[model samples]
Target: MSESSPDEPPNSAAVLESMTLLATLSTAAEVGKSVARRRLGRDPSAQEPPDRAAIHLRNTGRTLMDLLMQLALSRVPLDHPEEPLPHAVRHFDLLLKLRRAERLTQDMHQRLLSLYPEVSSELVEEARLLRNKIARFWETAPSDPDSPHLSDVLEQGISFVVWTRHEVPVE
Candidate 1:
């Protein structure tokens, strides 16, 4: 058997770990969404009562999305004068942007639902359909051969330092 290069990932293990993490993240998001829906008493067939609770829920969702975006952006390496980002890196960037768009669509749907207009129902339905499509795209696109592994993207995102306590020495 030929020895694999150091840069070559252990495909099975990486994929399994990534899938597990994805499941966990998906479950957490679903739980959060469920709680929000319950608190807001959201019914797709019926318009939800506009209240502070619904506004708070929407704000919480937006905050979560903002945090996720910050985390993802932190992973991006500083641009070099001579070298371009790797294919996987670019794919990761695209993935993050798609996620933001998905979140925006979700928020739009929530807002449309609150409007409770007869004509707005059609817009809400369209937004719901778009959100579902976006979710599916986000779930499956990263696993493509040409795309970066989920674990790699997540690890990179989580590996950056936001602050340091150590003092820098003068040159």
Candidate 2:
């Protein structure tokens, strides 16, 4: 009974809208997968001979959103973001630096927290546990504590979080 626009076909409007929605969703999935592979480092194992990307990207539709929400967790394969800072990836090397610091300033803690904030409690805890292990290892203290460690993974995950979560001075 109501008047419809002359250019619009009212009878087939629902069908047309459905088609549009389907196309939009399809495009969105395509774009999402492309970004996952390119930027997020799609699971290399999916490829023949296992390329060295970080994420395991199959059937990740549900968990992908959760993982993506994490600010510090990254797709890189490093143990820490600041790896090779002192030429090696040993806890002792870092432990030495920490011990050498005349004072463990709040700034140092804040700097680390900035990379992986308190919001990311699990990683912070993991890093702390690793530190404890390093100290324990230091007591017995091998000639070199250089070995495979999760410091790089922990470091890489300890990246700066979302902008709003951090302060940005207006420059």
Q: Report every candidate's CA lDDT.
A: 0.51, 0.36
**Candidate 1 residues 32-121, lDDT tens each?**
987897788775445555553246334534554455566556556655524333444455556655575566556656655665453245
RMSD of each: 13.4, 23.5
Clashing pairs in 1: none
Query: Ten-residue segment with the worst summed lDDT in candidate 2?
Result: 49-58
The alpha-carbon deviation from the true structure for residue 166 of candidate 1, after best TM-score superposition, in angstroms, is: 40
> What digit string (tens of lDDT, one per residue) describes model 2 on residues 1-171?
677799653444554466557557756875686688668765422332111111111112113223323312332445545534322323333333333221122112223344343224554354344445434443543454663243442332233222212321112
TM-score of 2: 0.22
- Clash count in backbone of candidate 1: 0
Residue 69 lDDT (model 1): 64
| Per-model TM against the reference | 0.38, 0.22
Worst 10 residues of 1 by lDDT: 161-170
